[model samples]
Structures are given as structure tokens and as C-alpha cells.
Target chain A: MASETKLSHTTALILHALDAGLVYGFSVMEMTGLPSGTVYPALRRLERDELICSQWERQSIADAEQRPARKYYKLTVAGRATLEASRRRYPLLERLIPTVEAKQV
Target chain B: MTARVDMVVRAFQRGFLSCISLLVPSGQRAEWRREWQAELWHVRRACAPAGAVSWQAEREVTAFCLGAFQDALCLRLHAPKNEPRIALLHGSALQCLLFLGGVLAASYGLTLLLPGVRVESHPERYQVRSGLIMIQDEAYSNDWVAATIPVERFRDWETTRQRYFDGLAFYRIGEQAVSAGSHGTGGWEVAEASKNLFSLLGLPVRFASQEGEADAGLPQAILSDAVWKREFGGDPRVVGSVLRVGGRDVRIAGVAAEGGWRLPGKADVWLLERDSEIAAGGRGHVVAHLTNQGRSEMWASYVHIDAYSPDEPGDNLCGFSFEERTRGPWGIYQFTVLLAFLALPAITTVSMGEYSVSSHRPSWSRRLCRWGYMGAKIALLLPIVYFLSLDVAYWHTTLYSLASEYAQLAASFSICLFGLRWALLDQRQRCPVCLRHVTNPARVGLASRTFLAWNGTELMCTAGHTLLHVPGLPTSWFSTQRWLYLDTSWEFLFTGSGVG
Candidate 1:
């Protein structure tokens, strides 16, 4: 049902960022150049609409890194199908956000 | 920058986010706050890494924290409404009782604003002055409406009956063309009474006095409250003005207080007359103050006009017969409400279905709570019917008219019967244990298959306590609605939603 509906540009950006391995809310905001307010709420909507899913990283991992545990997002199967449809609707979406490996390298 | 300044700036950013968290709904506030706080930590680290203080980086963090307010606002706006609180008030037992109490309180408050209805509800204030009796001719003794003693007979009785009475006041109810100052002439009901009538009755003067006393002029007139409002536009200036009644210019003394207890007839104006010849010429109702012996004699005799006999002990002929002619408005309302409640079972089913003492039966406390709720609804409804009926009866008129009493009776019966019927029907639809109205009705089986099997609408208690089967048609096997208790095995159906 959620896959059938059209995704907004900001929502599609967050979904595309999640698909490209920019998983955390801050990473999505950085990649999309959207503010923290726009990225976080759009991520929440995608998660609620079942286009994306979220889980907190292990507390030990955050303690090893000496920072708070980050909530990471991953695209569901339905979300990947919806992203394919959104990619057709907004052709510049893939060019808008780069892959995590590409940005790091 | 100093360490304290950096610490203060970091604290302000976190404090702003904390304030924004309040906008989110309480159920999801903690998770929403944690998510935002975690992201904020990462953002601050990326902006100013390695314990460095950069103004641009601090400004970016501040702007990042401000975005939380919008996110928090969006979550708050989209949060599901508090469904349980709304369901608790919709058709719940507590809501029914509250609605009845609210309307009852409003009706009582309205009665305080209406003088006629207030006096009717509390009849002690309008009790006819003690020792006051009306005397009439023998021909008109049985009928107070047509009962009047000729002025000559009253004059003859005045000279002969000084030993039997203290004072006598005569009032003739008639209609005369009246005009006040610039107000046009209209036919107004007038009570032509002797100048000493107010004093003779030993009644306190209630009219508002301005220029002089109510008895300043020889032939002054006092306007009834209805007439004062209708003809004079309720002006205080009209008190001192002249009013022409039947081609005679009479000074307006003052306006009478609003009252439902007008004796003889409902008059708009009391035209006081100084000329004894004119007052003593016409036939009119005479009120006489009776001494102790006169009172004893009046009560002891049934026929006092042409023949006085001490045979009757219970009947009094010359007392306030006009009030006794009909049950007052409040009396009629009380009787009608009682009759309506008595006839309630005939109109609708009164029995709350019988409960069985099985393993599935509710606890004794739960049963007591259900009965107590039913009793509270009925207790609140009684006064609601009373005050609302009187409110409808006396809202428009200042006097007790027969039509208003009839309206009160109709309102009383209609409101009481229908209100109680709805209350019972609502109770039947509610779950006995939790007192919440059952929801999600689904039809089971065809209506034509009722003879072969149970065919009715099945409704489940939202709390998963029981299922209600209301037959589409009442048969011998399913004469009334039945409640089927859901056992512990069925608890899985209500798991995640927190019902059972």
C-alpha cells in the first residue's frame, strides 16, 4: 500500500540517502544539505510509512566510539521498490546525493 | 573563549531542544527526545571537532538545534488524538450523568431569572395573607369567576359587619382604554380598587417610589410590571407621568413588582379611586380581614352567603377559591412527571437484563458500580425534568396561565419518558464491567435463518470483556439481548492494543 503512493522530493532524498548507506539522521541531513529539522521528520515519515526501518546501534559500540548511540535507517523491500518509482519521478534524485564510499574515498 | 562560555552555549542549545520536546505527545516524547539528542551530539562534533570553539560551527549547531522545534511541532500535530478520553465521554455512564446534572443546574439557574417560575416552584413566598377572605353574593357563591358582591350590598355589610371584620377592600376587574404620556392608547386590563385598598390589605408597598409616596395623588394608578414594560417601555420616567384611563387623566404612582399571585383577575394596571360614590356604585370582589371569631365562623360553615351552618368542618367557601380552582403550575408538573415515570415501563422495557453468578460473571463490586451508575442517572434526571419543565412553562409570561401549565405537563412527560428511555437503552449498549459503550457491530447469520439458528448483530466490548448478541428478531429462545463472556484463551485477540 505504501509503495503505491508517490514520495515527496525531501522524502525521496532521505530514502535515497538511506539506500546509499548514509544511514543516520545527521548523515542524511549532510548528504541532502537539508536542515536537521527537515531531514529528521522526513526520515520519521518514511519509517512510519514502512518505506524505511530504524534501530539503535549497540550501546557498547557508542561507548567504544566515545559518543551517543546513533539510530540507523535501512530501506525495506517496499521502500526499495518505492525508491525505484521515485527515481523515475525525480530523475535528479540519484545525482543529488552521493554514495557513502564515493564521498569517503 | 573561556571554558564556562563554551559550556553555557552548549547548555543553551540543549535547553532549547528540551523546551521543544514538550510539544511532542507524552507517549512518544522520550523516544523523540532521545533521537533528536543523539543527532544533535553528532552534529556538534562534526561542526567543531577536537574541543575547538569556532563561531561559525557554534552558529551551525544553534541553527541545527532550532530545527528540532519544527520537527517536534510536526510530531505533535500528527500524533493520534487521545481516543480513550473521548470514548470515556461519548455515551459513557459518567457522561450521561454529567449531561443530566449540567442541564439540571442550567434549568435551576434559569428559574432564578424568571420571577413567576421562581414563585411557583417555591410557593411559601406567595401564600395568601392569613385571615384574608373573599365575600360574595349567594347567587354566585359556588363560582368565584362570576362571584361578586354588589357595591350596595358591600356598603350595607360594611355598616352592619364592623364587629365581624377588621377592614374591607373592593376591586373591580375591567378593561379600559389607557394612554401614557406619548405612548398611544390601547385597551389595558385595569383593576379599579378603592384608594385605601393597599393599606387595607396590610401589604407592603413594592413599587419603586421617586417623586413622592404611592398614595401622593388622590386618584393615582400603579402599573403592573407587564404593563410598565409593554406600554411604558419600562421607563422610570413613566412613574411620575400622567396616564389617561377611560378619558380621565390619572398620575402614575409607580410600577408593581412581578408576581404570579394576582387575586380576582390578572390586571395590567390598578386604578386607585378616591371618590367613594364611584367606587361603591359598581359590583366587585371584596377582600375582608376576619377577626378570630369571624375566621372560626367562616371555616365552620359551608354555606355562608344566604345561609350560615356549622355542619361542615372541612370546607371553606369564602377563602382563596381562585387558587383552589386548579392545581398550580408546579403541582401539575410534579403530577405529570410522576405519571410519566409510572407509565415508563409501558412505553419501554425497564428491566436491566438479569446477570448470572457464573465463572464469567463480573465481581460484586463491578455489579454494584453498574447499578450505582443507573441510580445516579435517574436521580439527576428527576430535577432536570422538574426545573426544565418549569423553565419552559414560565419563560414568556409573568402570570400563571392555563396554557403554560398544559405546556409544562407536556414538557414534563415528554422529557422524563424519552430521557429515561434513552438512558436505559444507552446502559444496555454499554459494557457492564467497564461502563464503556460497546463498539464494532458485525451482523452474523441471515435474518431469515433466525428460526433455525441464532441470527443477530454481534457487538464486542472494546475492552474484550464480553460479546453482546442482540437478536434481529426476538424469538422464544432469544427473547432478550445476551452477553457472551470471552475467556482467558481469547485474550490473544486484544494483545497489542492493551484492551484485556
Candidate 2:
């Protein structure tokens, strides 16, 4: 049940972040107000499942300011298609509620 | 909030310890740490339940997240029961070998497509003393007949002069041809005659013969294609025109194609008759003649000396020999063969070396072994290929020779591919040498204690004899440095003690 919930939210956030140019964890957090706790683990699960792909940025000015480095993520070709299909299947309200609730506390 | 912090700390610790157990080698330690931290952070957020905003609820959620994180971490840290070994098909060395093999095959294919002709002539004489003189003898009975043939008629002649010149035909001789010596007279006469005959036949003969005494005594000259183009500007009307040569007016009797004469190096001017005496008597002359079938032959003949010395009380004095001289075409073939052989090995060696170096990292012993193997393979194949190529080339079936050349190149390429793969992957290890994490170590010195287990086994086996001393000494001495040294000395001191 936890994994199923995680799979759905992670997929939704990845799609939303990708569309918003929130291609990395910090950017996703800034865009969606999701804590590092929610965003990164979802990103990893999405990557492991082949729904999204991530690559470590060789040099990051923001990372240098914060820590050593950060990995950038993007929707794979399959992920983009899946997101489009899922958007057609679910009502806009249903998708927004879970994301909003996940973001809120 | 405190409970959540405590849970987060526990999750982080578990993940960190799992990573440590996996023994993230020094080179990748930093990356593993970052990945673990990120994972811990994500686990906390994702596993947090829908809440009524209580500290106890938050604590319960965090602890649950920690437990989940530990389970995942433990799974990752444990080695798989069926860990995948590197496959021959997927290895990087294999990929490189495939790429190199394709390139070499393409190159060998391209070499076959180049257009060029390889000519063969038997006893193929390259340098000739007298090409035109030989032609005259081959054409007529003697120098007298060649001389009297009227230089205008001789221009129609076509001869193949491989070692000498090609397509030479005499046209005319000047009045002073009688004064030039045997060497000069016959060649000059032939040159003039060939020029005149080609002109009369309306064929292209580039050079004209000089008429006046000023030019006549010097030499009879035939014009080259370049000179013809320069002097006549490629004018067809200039065939019968007179030109100045050696300070005398000479008549152009014919035009010649520059390709006709196979002069040793460069030949622009051919003298008709340099000595008048030889021209008159036709003694001691050589000439080249080509049959209609394109085969060339040389003839050395003499003219009746009595014809020139008619006033003297003459006996039959044809003061020259009629001998057929033949030399085989072995020299040129040998030279080309030597060049091909010498160049092949050097090129192959370089290609093999390049393949070896690029495919694998440098290791002295491995490289040496691969080099030796490739060298032996090539050495065994070269002589057979060379002789086979020669036999094919001899029959003028050089297409087969070309094919064999390509095959040799292909074999060389294949050898290079295999050699490179063998060289590169020969000693690669599955784990990092110094830290014991999954890695490929090129050097043994860089291996860590865990990776050093194999080498340690070898050392122990080599010193197994030292474990027993006089059959009764304490085995503890094997592990101690001082006792071990004493034991080693005792074995050496008593060679007949049956340690073997």
C-alpha cells in the first residue's frame, strides 16, 4: 500500500516537475514545495522503475554553494508518454488533491 | 518533532552502516555517501502518513520509515547469490575489437577497388644499348637493308621496346649521316627514317629531322611530345615543316605520340645517325622489333661493308655478327617483391601494435606475450602469401595476387583484433584492489587486503615447505619472522633432507 501510494505520487510529481523545468531536486522543491524527503526518494523509485532518468551534473554552481554536487533528473521517453496517457485517464481534481496533500505537512 | 528527528537519525545510521558493510571503495566512497543520504531523506518524507498533526504520530511515522530504510539498505549491501560475471560479448575489449576489425576489413576491400595495371615481360631487359638499331635488325636482313629502306618508309614501323624505347620508326637520314661513327650513324639514321615514315603515313611524329650540314654532322634528332607541343603548339600542319636543330634546318617528317617510346628515363631527342661510316656500312648495329601480337624481340646484324666501299677492290665484307640477345625480366620483379615484403611486415607490426595498445591497458608481460603471438602468426603466413602472390603475378593473373594481398591484410587485421582484446582484458579484476568494492584494477600494487587474498594464497603455498622443520619443530615458527628465517636456512643447509 505504501509502495503503491509512493509509485503514484512519484509519477505525478516527476511529470509535473518535468513540465515546469524543475529538472533537479532543489528545483522540484522550489517549484512544488515538496521537502527533500518526499522528492528524492520518489525520484529514485521512478528511476529504478524506468519511468524517469537521472544524471549527476558534472559541475553545479548551486551545489558548490550548498554541498558537493546534485543529480539532475528528467522524464525518459517512456515516462513522458506515460504521463500523457495518465493525464487523459484521470480527472484533473484527482491528480491535484494527492499532490497538494503530499506537499502540505 | 523530536521523535521524527530521532527516527531520521536512526534511518541515516542504518543506511550508512549498510553502505560501509558493502565496503564502498575509497574512489567511490563519496558518491555512495551522497546517494545514501539522499535515499534516507526520501524515505522519511514518502513514508509519513496522513496526519492529525501530533508529535507522537510524527514519531511513529519516522520510526516506521527508518525500519523500511534499513530493510532496503540491507538488501543492497548483501552480495547477490548469482552475481553477473562480465560477458565476452559485452566486454569493452570485445566492442573495441569489433570496431577495429570492421575498419581493417573496409580498408582491405578498398585496396581491391583501386585501378592499376601490372605488366610482365619475360627476360624483361630494362636497359638497352641500341633500341632502334635492334629494331632495324629484327625488321630487315642486315643494316644495309635497314639503311637503304628509305627513311620515309621506316616511319610506318611500330616496335615494342620494353628495356629500350617503344614505337620507334625511322623516316629519313641527312646527307652527313655517312660521316658519323657506327654508334651514332645507325641510331641517327633510324631516328630520321622513323620520323619521315611516320610523317609520310600521316601519323603523329613530334620531332623533325635536320637537313643542312650544320645539323647533319652533329646527330639526327627525333622530337618528344612536350617539345612538339611547345614548338608546333600542337599544330597538325607542322608535320612536314622544317625546324632548326643544332644550328641547322631540319624537316619534320612525322608526329609521334609521347607514349610510344619507352625511354629509360626521359628522352626528348633521338639521333638518326651520329657516325657516317656506320650508316654507310651498317656494321655492329642493334635494333628492337615488336610483332603484331605485341611481343618484343631484339636483333643484332651487320650491313654489307662492300656497299659503302665500292671503289675499293671488295671482297664480301659484312663486318658484323648476327646474334639474338635475350635477358629475363627477373630483376624488376625481384625488386618489387622485396619492396612489398619489407613494407608488409613493418606495416603489419605497426597496425598490430596500435590495436594492442588501444584495446588494453599497458602491462609489460601481457603486451609481450600478445606481441609474440601476433608476430609468430604473421611470420608463418607471409612467405606462403608472398610465393602465392608471385605465382599468380607470373601468370599475369594479378587479380588473384591482389585478392591474396587483401586476404593477408584481413588476417593481419583479425590478428590485431584478437591480440588487442587478449592484451587488455588479460589481467582485469572484478573488484577494486585496495578497497574491495566492485572495480577493475589494472595494477596489482593498487589492490587492497581483501583483493590481495589470491596473491597471499600463492605466497603461502610457495612457503609450505618452511612450515615443517626437522619434522618436530613447533609449527608456530612458520608464522614468526626469526624462526621462519632459521627454518629457511636449515632447509638450504641440508639439501638431502627430502624436503621435496
Top model by TM-score, which number? 1
lDDT value, residue B347 of candidate 1:
84
**What is the lDDT for B147 in model 2?**
41
The DockQ-based CAPRI class assigned to model 2 is incorrect
For residues B1-500, could you state the per-residue lDDT of candidate 2 as single tens digits? 46676667566566544645354444444654565455444443444443224555545444433443443443354434432233323433334445545544554353344321122221121223322233233344443333434322222223212332344433332333221211122222233333232322232434342342244434334555554565557666555445444444454544445433332123344444432212333222233333333233223244332212224442333323212221112332344445554554453332211111122233576456545544543443333333333333333332223243344344444444444334333312111111111122122222243333311111111212221111112133222111011234445544542222
Model 1: runs farther than 4 Å from truth? A1-33, A56-105, B1-170, B177-187, B194-207, B212-215, B233-235, B246-248, B257-264, B273-278, B281-317, B321-350, B363-399, B429-500
Model 1's CAPRI class?
A: medium
Q: RMSD in angstroms, candidate 1?
A: 8.4
Task: For all candidates, state DockQ relative to the true structure.
Answer: 0.64, 0.04
Query: What stretches of model 2 exceed 4 Å from their correct place?
Result: A1-105, B1-222, B229-240, B246-255, B263-285, B288-335, B338-500
- Two-chain DockQ for model 1: 0.64
How well is each residue in B138-208 modelled by candidate 1, as lDDT tens digits?
Answer: 55666665646566555555555465578777788788998765788889888888666766554444454
lDDT of each: 0.75, 0.39
